[model samples]
Target: MRSHHSLTNKAWAEFHVDGLPHVHRVFPNGESTMAIVDGLVHGDYVAAAVNDTAVTLTLFSWPASSISRYCYAIHLQIGRVEGPTGRLAVCVQVTAAREVSPVEDYWCMTVDERVALFDRGNAHPVATFRLEYENQRTVELPK
Candidate 1:
């Protein structure tokens, strides 16, 4: 049998009030995709930290079979690192290409209908909400 994902909703949001890990989230498509309260990742990934927060997240994989090095860095400003004594590291190292892989396995999709991937620096939406609350729908790709 396949192992189920561990990032349930409660754990992701509350960060373990009972001194344990693993989150639980539910949605209409829980069987197809998990509920992501925020953010998403694609391809092989891992996020870790020594404190309740982290110093950084790095990627050092090849683009394919090439040997070119891509230099990238991530800096975080978190409130957990201020003054705490927790020894925990939550690592999610996974990758999937399916449209639902992130939504299902990683909970990458947003629950808020207003969140978007891109913006035009305007105070409006680039896409319209024509979705029906009664059915599953396919995403419309831009040409």
Candidate 2:
């Protein structure tokens, strides 16, 4: 993800995705928001995470589809947010048809339900990365 940090506002970070037509912003308190850059499609924020190093967000979108008459496309975005820095870690696009309909309305589903749907193993990873935190001082021993 390409990020732009404002020199004046240390708590503000803004970034955009390559294919997606949206600009995502992360505030100082680890809250994230998105604006439609092109105004062509709509999206919704599904979940978020805050840690010592980063704040992560998950966004969901249902794009139009021609192959599946009954089902729409599923687009999942996983992004990270740190103080004045944000990154789009993973973008998952599921276009294949499913045996059972996932839900009636994605927006109506609870956060836990939405998270479960994302983790249902329908989408496979094309690549994986091993991340190491820079500020780590020690490893916790498993008791």
Cα lDDT computed for each candidate against the true fold: 0.26, 0.40
Error of 2 at 127 (Å): 5.2
Worst 10 residues of 2 by lDDT: 34-43
- Per-residue lDDT tens digits of candidate 1, residues 30-123? 3322222223321221224545444323221111212321211121222232324433332322121212111222233332211221121322
The C-alpha TM-scores of every prediction are: 0.19, 0.31
Error of 1 at 49 (Å): 2.8
Which 10-residue window in model 1 sums to the lowest lDDT? 94-103
Candidate that would win on TM-score = 2
For each predicted model, how many residue pairs clash, with residues at least 3 apart or on different chains? 6, 0
